[model samples]
Target chain A: MAIEVRIPTILRTYTDGAKAVEGNGATLDALFADLDARHPGIRARLVDAGELRRFVNVYLNDEDVRFLDGINTALGDNDNVTILPAVAGGSV
Target chain B: MKYDTPLEAVGNTPLVGLPRLSAAIPGNLGSDGHGAGAVRLWAKLEDRNPTGSIKDRPALHMIERAEADGRLTPGCTILEPTSGNTGISLAMAAKLKGYRMVCVMPENTSEERRELLRMWGAEVIPSPAAGGSNTAVRVAKELAAEHPDWVMLYQYGNPDNAGAHYATTGPEILADLPTVTHFVAGLGTTGTLMGVGRYLREKVPGVTIVAAEPRYDDLVYGLRNLDEGFVPELYDASVLSTRFSVGSADAVRGTRDLLQQEGIFAGVSTGAILHAALGVGRKAAKAGERADIVFVVADGGWKYLSTGIYTAATTEDAVEALQGQLWA
Candidate 1:
């Protein structure tokens, strides 16, 4: 199964400047491992000690993976993964 | 409802029903095709506030709370980091109370917001747009330090921001819809959800408080993602049942749906909130449970008209038109 992972601007360098890359894994952890195989050191930026980095937010199909199963969240075919750096949101 | 002054006319907005939109959802329709047991949607029309947005509730309350405690005295300058509504609300209050108002806002915010702030006699300071509101908040904090005399209400971390909703918005919703099963609002400073969520949780046996957060990098005007560096001090995860991340396209679609189906022309963030409300409503309907979902209409669309959202040819066009601009 092919899952599309969208990379943030800050981490575009690791993806060879590609905005999105394709990977396959049953779970997000395995997905990251697949991505790391293709893009070395990319996994390190997103994960630290098997936990998602504090400044990184990963969403699977617009749902926060943190609220789901975090890195262990199961991935399905046709799922879209988005990774973004934590920035201060809009001021209300 | 007649009030002594405009400031006194902050809350008590209309709670209108969205029968058409609610019935359009397949899940909301009963098995027998009747209205009973159908998931329903109610809008708390916060755009009806004096300053034309829900921020009036917190802005007025924060200033009043500060005044009551002697922190904000006459002639003091009130500083804040705002993309639009809060600054305009504060400026209106400051003008009436004989205090100077200053707002640190992102440069990418709609021109209407800048003009509104200036019209209300607030001094506007523009921050960089790279990191969005995060940059604005940092700049405001720096400015506050440089000008210690200026009292920054600091809505992101201020208790009064949420306290304002707890005291007024929360009670108003319950009084209007006692059977409200779900409460949804945009996630910004987290004041609305925390305040209203806590209030409903105490009174209602089982109430679901859902937060509608902007999708990361989607940039819906006034909403925020908690995972983002700055979690509003008022935010408590325990208070929320679940959070939905909405993208700009979905937000635009929801906004158009509200205007087209229900005639509620609200800000972009409200559209995101409605999307989340509908999501939860669908879940409850799928479970064959009755639900009374109430969502917030954060602000009016007047300020966002220049962004071409309401008049765009299509939802995609609307989303494109809103690029790099804070439509909420």
Candidate 2:
């Protein structure tokens, strides 16, 4: 399956300013590996060692992967993977 | 009642202790006035403000700073992009000070926020919700371009937000608890964390700063995070000895647990902080160490009561069934 990985605005610098890129995999883990292969250093930014970085979120079709199968969540063709960064602003 | 206002009530909020919760997590240091094992969890209750949120701190500061520098006039409209609190604060403050306030907000904001702003008499412009606050910022920028006389506070990128907490909230916490070992707070806007964290880190070199982030995928109010970007401009992450993130459901459960068990009705983000504090507490207990962790509960739970967070229908069968459906 080919899924579209949406990169956050901050991480675009690592992906040649592209907001999104294509990856091939059947599950979330495979998709991430595919992304890391294409854009080196991307995996380090998204996953830490063998775990998903606490700050990074992988949303498959807008649903949190944790609520699904976590890193093993199966992906279908044309699935959208959104990488959203924390917006920590505002007073209080 | 015609009463004198102290610079429009920019600061000076009450700090209360969470005695019940403090007991559950032992070895936590108590404030100087309290007994040992009776650690104090002081909440900087911003909900008590005139606008019911802490954004009052920055909204007032931003307006006053602009006025002091001769950049704002009575007729000029105050503009900004916000999700909820900032706009509500600016609306009440600007209207009282004789300025027209216009706010650009994501269209998906809660109905309560929109009605509150309308009650305060501020003009609201809705931007696309799918684009999040980014769209609101773009809209604000476009409006400011068309209206040359408008002044936009731009809280997302504004230093004033963090500065407000630094100058006020930070000092207040220090005065209240000079021996605070750890400071925990949610990472939204990074203003509270950045400002308070900087001040505490400087005043108390050993003070540990921890960000209680929602588990990365928890997008209740559209707040999400990526690994590459951290809100650390005013925040020094090196000062933090540890960081803990809690799942949204875990946070919600924590809030409910605190309210029922400890009687502290704080918001979901506060629950995240509490859950993180408990994690820190458990770790300290295992090491047989004493550590005082102070968490900031930004607001009361009144705003989220409608969501039924505190009123979950957790029957025995329901609980078991929900647990049964977990993915292997």
Q: Least accurate stretch of 10 residues (summed lDDT) in model 1 chain B?
A: B218-227
User: What's the distance in Å from true for residue B199, model 1?
Assistant: 1.3
Per-model lDDT: 0.86, 0.68
DockQ of 1: 0.43
How many clashing residue pairs are found in candidate 1? 0
Off by over 4 Å in 1: B31-37, B216-228
- Can you list the residue pairs that collide in candidate 2? A85-B224, A85-B225, A85-B226, A86-B224, A86-B225, A88-B188, A88-B189, A88-B190, A89-B188, A89-B189
Over A1-92, each residue of candidate 1 has an lDDT whose tens digit, in order, gives 99999887667778888889999999999999999999998998889999998767788987778778889999999999988765544329
**Model 2: per-residue Cα lDDT over A2-82, one tens digit each:** 788877666777789886899999888888888878788887777777777766666776545655677888999988887
TM-score of each: 0.94, 0.72
Please state the error at residue A5 of candidate 1 in Å. 1.7
- Best candidate according to lDDT: 1
User: Residue-wise lDDT of candidate 1 within B109-220, one digit each (tens)?
Assistant: 8899999999999999999776677878889999999999999999989999999999999999999899899999988888898899999999998899888887634432
